[model samples]
Target: MILFDQIIFGPIHSRRLGLSLGVNLLPIDAKICSFNCIYCECGFNTTMHDSPIPTRDQVRETLDAKLHEMVAEGQIPDVITFAGNGEPTLHAEFEGIIDDTIALRNKYCPTAKVSVLSNSTRIHKPHIFAALNKVDNNILKFDSAIDRTMKLMDQPVGKHINVAWFIEHLKKFDGRLIIQTMFLRGEVQGEKLDNTTDEEVEAWIQALEQIRPQQVMMYSLDREAPTQNLQKVSVDELNIIAEKVRAKGFDVSVAG
Candidate 1:
């Protein structure tokens, strides 16, 4: 329901990241994420689009202007987040864009952290990996560690992207990244699905232990999902799970 019409928008308060400024690398009129998650706020992906993805120079200039305006207004963002209608890593100039963003961030809002909310699909690429490592908070999505649950929930565009694929690549971060998981329950095509189940949670914990991320971010549905029968996992349930993971010495943050 929400497609960011501008290249650089927001400075809105985020549940996970504070006073955040958003950056949309995909087309302004269409969604181009690698994963067609049922809970994506902008709905499913659109193949056709009227506008093009912003270029590196355009992003840098517009972001510079925005940061200048925010500075003049005395309203600095807590984080400059790369998130919007779709995946930011898919952009051809993503590495260059991150470079420009870091420069602009240092020039305008030195204290503002640069964060990217990726689906953990493109991190296998050397350039993408380098770019993510450069960011202050490289938040990646790993909704379910079970292959079946992940395929059903995330519906990754690449058929090869299974739980194992994620684990193998996520481990490459080597405790430098943060893992973000969405906890929820529902039925898809008459099949019952719930990541909170003991089996699912245990497998997820195992994957986290292997990755050894610096922190883990857990949250449930905050917006209407495109599909039906989806149920939101409550804050109490999230905390219950967080406690188990925390026992394993993983710093977990819950945004309910």
Candidate 2:
């Protein structure tokens, strides 16, 4: 079953961060986010709505208990990850949750790092950025570099958020900005889908130069996606893309 079928999973394994213990900040049915990407493994949000946000105390208690249990059982996760059924930042009490989780992680697993898997939509928020900076890994999503293409692929809530603005704002962040991109080709709403084109990749590469992220996390779909037409880029293709990005002087990791 998909990991989110439960509130938490892993310390299982990760290509980038080893032995990650997941922390699901979103409630069971409150999997809300700004994007409706076709490749999301949780499938598209069924409600198309945001929620009565989960409490910070609730997340802290659950996470603290889990950490304690793992410690007691001699299970030491490498990272305490803020990733779950939906974007962790959407939880209104996100900053508090991050603070609480970090404290608990230090108390139980001092060697472990705290990380987040975010969409970068909330990067503009001062509070969110402050919390993100505290994490060991800030895995932010930037699926496409072209505005029109991004709108179709990510389907974000605010129309004003575009590639240029994203790059400009990302400059404010002090910590390592781990860019996570999904390379795929698939049909959405009866149209052909392809981000594998030379033009698209070139745009992404150029944008990457401006952002100058610490590293790039490139991967393709491996789980059931919202649309059937979406196709994963092969390992050879992923490696080729990584090589090109590396040529420009940035480290890249192939997750798939």
Candidate 3:
């Protein structure tokens, strides 16, 4: 329901990335993503538009202009984030755009970090992997470690995706990636779903050990989700989960 109308929309405060400037590569009026997540703030993928994605030149021009303006106003952001309508890596010129963004950030706001929020669906693509490696924060999502729970939660576009395959693919990043997970419980359609259970958490912890990310970001919903059945997990529960992950010798942060 929150559709961004411009390529550069905010220098808004982010829970993780402070004073962030959002870059939307997808269509302005609709959601464009590979996953039809039940808790997506932009609603379901079925409601997305058929509009063509923005051109590399268009993104370059818009982002450059915005950075110049922010610099002149002495309002440089802490981070330039690639997140908006949907999965940003889906852009045809994603690699070129990342190059452009990095160049502009260096010129106008040299101290600012370049970050990308990816669904981790396209990491197998050589170009996408290379582009992600160039950014400051290569944040990837993995909500559940169990195949059945992942299928129920993420609802990925490709039915061939499985937890085992996904985990193996994630290990390709080694320790360079930042893993982000959203903790919640609810029922969609008719089946009961919960990822905070000991079984789910233990499985997720084991997977994280294999991937061995630099850090893990754990949080619960803070906005109205597309699915009304979802319930936000408490902060105390999140801390407990974070501790479990921390006990494994990996750094973890909890957000509610």
Candidate 3, 1-256: lDDT as tens digits: 6877888889899998899999999998788788888888887774646666789999999999999999999998999999998899999899999999999998999999999999899898999999999999999999999988888888899776788877888899878999999999999889899999999999999999899999999989998898978999999999999998999898888888
What ranges in model 2 sit over 4 Å off? Answer: 1-7, 48-53
Per-residue accuracy of model 1 over 1-256 as CA lDDT, tens digit each:
7899999999899999999999998889999988999888899889899998898889998999999999999999999999988999999999999999999999998999999999999999999999999999999999998988998899999977999999999999988999999998999978999999999999999999999999999999998888889999999999999999999999999988
The backbone clash count of each candidate, in order, is 0, 0, 0
- Go through the candidates in order and give each one's C-alpha lDDT: 0.94, 0.82, 0.90
lDDT of model number 1: 0.94
The C-alpha TM-scores of every prediction are: 0.99, 0.93, 0.97
Of the two candidates 1 and 2, the one with more favorable TM-score, higher being better, is 1
Q: Against the true structure, whose lDDT is highest?
A: 1
* Candidate 3: clashing pairs of residues: none
Evaluate candidate 3 by giving its C-alpha RMSD to the native, one decimal: 1.1
Candidate 1 residue spans exceeding 4 A from truth? none
- Clash pairs detected, candidate 1: none
